[model samples]
Target: MFNFGIFLLLLGAVLVYATVPIIKIFNITTTKGILVVKLSGLALAVIGAIIMFFAQFPQRLEFLRLI
Candidate 1:
């Protein structure tokens, strides 16, 4: 669980970092694509943070261990 959480966080960070360069390279000044990318990145980061946070809790850790 902890490992998964860390993986998710890293993946999210990578996605955000990667997408930024592409957007910049293409000169994506339009609101649509930029908004979509931003929203997706935000969602991914939030999900990753939530997973990491729950993984740190003792009860959640125990529950995860059971799985």
Candidate 2:
């Protein structure tokens, strides 16, 4: 799960950084298409963070409870 989360985070970063090439490859010319791709990337990054958070939740639970 951790590895998958890391992979997703990297994938999202790449998508955001390489948006132009992705748009060219996919023939996505519209502004909406670009927006969609960027939004999906953001969503993937958020999901990856959530996954990582849960993956390590048990180890951090005690500390969290103290707060």
Clashing pairs for model 1 are: none
In angstroms, how far off is 16's CA in candidate 2? 1.0
Error of 2 at 11 (Å): 1.0
lDDT of 2 by residue, 1-67 (tens): 7667777888888888899999999999999999999998988988887776656445544566433
Off by over 4 Å in 2: 57-67
Collision count for each candidate, in order: 0, 0
Candidate 1 — worst ten consecutive residues by lDDT sum? 58-67
Highest TM-score model number: 2
- What tens digits encode model 1's per-residue C-alpha lDDT throughout 2-54? 56767777777766778878698888888898877767777777787888776
Top lDDT hit: 2
What TM-score does candidate 1 get on C-alpha atoms?
Answer: 0.56
Overall local distance difference test of candidate 1:
0.73
For every model shown, what is its TM-score relative to the native structure? 0.56, 0.78
Candidate 1's C-alpha runs over 4 A off are 17-19, 24-29, 56-67
Q: How far out, in Å, is residue 20 in model 2?
A: 0.5
